[model samples]
Target: MLAVGAAALVLPLAAGAAPTAFAAPVSAPVLRAPAGGYEELMVPSKMGPVKVQVQWARHGGTAALYLLDGLRARDDRNAWSFETNALEQFANDNVTLVMPVGGQSSWYADWTSASNTNGQKTTYKWETFLTEELPAFLEGYGVSRTNNAALGLSMSGPAALRLAALHRDQFKHASSLSGPLNWNAPGMREAIRVMMLDAGRFNVDSMAAPWSPAWLRMDPMVFAPELRGLPMYISAASGLPGQHDRPAGLGGAYNTANAMGIEVISMVSTRAFQSRLNTLGINAVYDFPSNGTHSWKYWEDQLWKARPHILNALGA
Candidate 1:
């Protein structure tokens, strides 16, 4: 079995593809934007008013790209804002960048039950919020309910695809950056359990029962057939340290080691996911780097690579 401890350290921490023929570009809706480039939206959901940071679409276009955070999603701000330059990079793109903050260890799923641990009181209803509530609210901002894409890293990587798979009408484009697609894979549940517990004192059982249908419901491999025609970009890197894995100190070294192991796990699962898609005759742009770790630098690089495809798919 893999060492769950080191993997857990990064689980709390957080691909390239060629062009695929996507659906016909959807026309942009009339956009409503505050003069400020960015706006904070309080979207109401079963969990309560969830905070979402929106970078308005540039040039008056209304196509949106939803960016989901990792397992250790911050309650204060989405890490994409601070960890990467995504906001500025997409500043001039016609697509709106919709980032929902604070879903730590939630996997962006509709949980089976509430976890009172680590002060989590409300039942997680992220699947509903992202698919149903958020879309309805964004429609008022002139963002098309149907013109959008979903991209995520680490924990949310599988989530991005799952969201697109189950709700194809909402997310036309989907991408996973170093996310393990198969949850039912051996040792995956234990790793997830360790990571979830370390990240937020969360219990995996509260999200889904062991080997339950709910678990399979979230497994991308199981839903691979659903992803048949969607435009997809998937990427992963070898666990070996790359240029970005340079350590500043002992703590940095330790974190780097954890990140490496985590990436290896992701790499394995991603390949399995790719095999499943291949078997299903689903086409996706796949990138497997020679060396890298589970860090923001690689995810940033992959996102930049995937940006063009995302814009094209959303017709942004």
Candidate 2:
């Protein structure tokens, strides 16, 4: 029974193996201006000031995408920031890139009673932040806010949908790659436990007691009814390779083991969460990449693939 922290901290995602004995920092060329656009912004967050930096190729068009991060992904660098170069890939695609920063493990939810607002307990209000705050603030850049899409990796997968589901009028499309679709599942509790414990923030006694509802309240499945009518793109690396060094020998029996062991990310109890999305009558561009795992390689490919479909949904 670890004591949950009074000050919740989000552990960042894996970035190019830290200055290590084997791998060096990913060296990619800078996203040049004139052909690409870049900006480092300080946006307001429920926790504190957030710094968002983005670079994208400049092409003429109305396509836009918003990206969020996972718990282990930090503001400093994540798979995309340190390993994969985003601006280099989409610079000439005529798509506008919008990134709102500082949500490592925050789940991009609007806190109802966790954050501080007007000397009162408040919700993180992430919904308002992305849908209303950031868009309104970035409107000065001559970018259209009409039918933008949201893309996220890991924990942010659901966040992307939560945004679109809650504010469908604002986002024309939603896409999640390598994200945990079922948070309420029994299999999820262990991962969540490991995550909270590793971060020195765990309290089983408080599970679903008080503030816990806020977390589940933000899960997309809870809002599935609203999410069903939207155009979505979902992908996972099913029957895929595992993470870096995880093996089939390490008792790959537990949910976490299978998740980190093989590259295939799935639910043991309900393996077809992706297919279930189809059953809901929402048209989706779904891909179960062969031998894929939870890594930047999968994310980069998934985002690149989902680009056109999303843009078209936005009427770009």
Candidate 3:
């Protein structure tokens, strides 16, 4: 149960050992006729809260795509939610848009060490919340579990793959947009640190900690062995080997900043990690569009592309 830390989650501890509590989400927020022309709902989640948006037929679509957040992405909104007019995309189709509210930088792991004591932490019991709580709620709300898949961007990329990989019964399709799948690399870590610092949201304890053996154990790549048969859909920007802006030459043949000694963790190519997947016979579908970068524009397009895969996974 170490992986399932209890009582430590932010909860109230009364003198009489009573429970701590937050007013349970009475009425989740939903905005119909979105400004961008979609139905939007700011729903509560175990991780915290999510903003669920739908842009399909009025029949309450059967298939779903659970969108995840990046390290700096906020639960309040998303790149697609803020920018695109998703409602226009589903005028002819039926699909449910489910965005779980939290996990910025969470890497979407069943985090064994990131809860609050006494359910008091703003961060809720997410893994349980997502896999069980949220799913049940959605089912009640008319979402069919039999036709649900997940897709995320950047930091959430690995998670999208992991969820489907680890729980094929629940999620048959998963995808990531501009995500750094091989976080075990040095250059990738540094790039992340730089982004964290720039975003002013970098917390060593929050990002990765030696004290929390849970972090490593939660990583998807490390546990890919447990995830088989789940189809993976990936889209990422191209760049240097996990490291960007590398100085190169003929002798540059042997240079690597990704401490793991991955011959070349290509930011421009999904080489390193894909090779491993190839070995495991898990390369379902991957794309390294020569034009995309690790940015919002690329992800928007990537999400659009992954939508078909999401539908396929949902068997819709």
Candidate 4:
């Protein structure tokens, strides 16, 4: 079982809990369509209220696609909306785009213990917040309760798979782009520890005990069988610089080198997980491009490539 910290238990909003600047009532917010293009809602959770950005569908479809972010997710806006043309790509699609903000290095998991990172103490209860609280809250605002799909990149890639595997009835389809699926693989734990540290001085050992059963429990490869019948899409790059890469000078070269190393690890882990899925006879759309690196360009391409499948799964 996943360990829950004492401070992570869900509780009623205290009498004088801190009020959010934009929305009233720390527990719930009035859900309304954005005045312009998108709206932000503060969904209450055990850890605190989570800010979810919603882009209403032009066709008013009830189905939703939850898009998670990577280790460096910002609190301002989802990288999908900020860095890419995802909003424009799905403008005509008949599905709501749900993006949860600010989960840097959290891995979107329920941590065993509260962690102090950069001097801020947080009890990470992202699993409960996303799967339980956020869904229920979205349902009240006309989003489909069960007809949902999830996709993530990098750090959140495995999280998307694990959520779909464990809550098969909730998500109709799932996808991951450049995510590490095999958590317990050799050297993976240490790699994650270093990544977390680099991301925000986060300690991975506090999120899940080192080499514990919880680690295995969260590994998508270990639960590959659970995702057998789900319409799934998985993609990864070979860590090689392609047309999208434009190395300028020494700084650009250094950045590209770092990206290559991370993508190589992701490629190895994702391929191993995909191999397991194939061995288990679980059919999924696999996109293993030989020349792309771990960049938003590839993720954006994969999103467009998988758009039809995702919409089909949602019955759109």
Q: TM-score: which candidate is best? A: 1
Determine which window of 10 residues in candidate 3 has minimal summed lDDT.
6-15
Mind giving the per-residue lDDT tens digits that candidate 3 earns over 44-89?
A: 5654455554444345565666777655555445545554444345
lDDT of 1 at 269: 85
Candidate 1 residue lDDT tens string, 128-209? 9999999988897778889899999988999999999999889899999999887768677887877778777898889999
The stretch of ten residues in a row with the least summed lDDT in candidate 2 is 1-10
TM-score of each: 0.91, 0.74, 0.69, 0.88
Name the regions of candidate 4 deviating beyond 4 angstroms.
1-36
Instruction: For model 1, state the Cα shift of residue 120 in Å.
Output: 2.5
Clashes of each: 1, 21, 20, 0
Q: What is the lDDT of residue 47 in candidate 2?
A: 50
**Would you list the rank order by TM-score, best first?**
1, 4, 2, 3
Q: Where does model 2 exceed 4 Å of error?
A: 1-13, 16-35, 60-62, 112-124, 199-216, 242-259, 262-271
Model 2 RMSD in angstroms: 7.3
How far is 282's C-alpha from truth in model 2 (Å)? 2.3
Choose the strongest candidate by lDDT.
1
